[model samples]
Target: MPTPVILEDLQAAFPGWCIWRSSAGRLWATRNGRHLSQHEVDHGLCRTIDADDVAQLAEQLKEQETAEQAL
Candidate 1:
């Protein structure tokens, strides 16, 4: 898991998502209102990413949501 600071930043950027990491240090994020994993946003794709890339991750997730909605 990342430090509390990183987790907080991710939560703020992705307001309705439960973003965290696994015991093995793999990143995981799931939507709150809907029981959906981050993978669902990207058409069942999920990847482990660096904490420092949270901002880029947030943008990707947002874009995924927009793309899904358009489908």
Candidate 2:
């Protein structure tokens, strides 16, 4: 799949996140509205997550989703 399609899929898969690619080609995602708390951050949540490719970004997003659910 193409980058744009992958980005769209990611955006759809993680509705609470805004996903995009930088000019330098790094994939990034940030939460749409609410911010993570310090406790969440300390427990491994992040304000923003970046990955070199779609798969890694997806995996990270899934992990974040799990972390959010655990809260």
Q: Pick the candidate with the highest TM-score.
A: 2
Structural similarity to truth (TM-score) of each candidate: 0.51, 0.89
Per-model lDDT: 0.57, 0.87
lDDT of 1 by residue, 1-71 (tens): 23234667767766766777677766666666565466564574333323335555666566545655765
The list of candidate 1 runs beyond 4 A from truth reads 1-5, 35-56, 68-71
Candidate 1 lDDT for residue 61: 61
Error of 2 at 26 (Å): 0.5
Clashing pairs for predicted structure model 1, backbone only: none
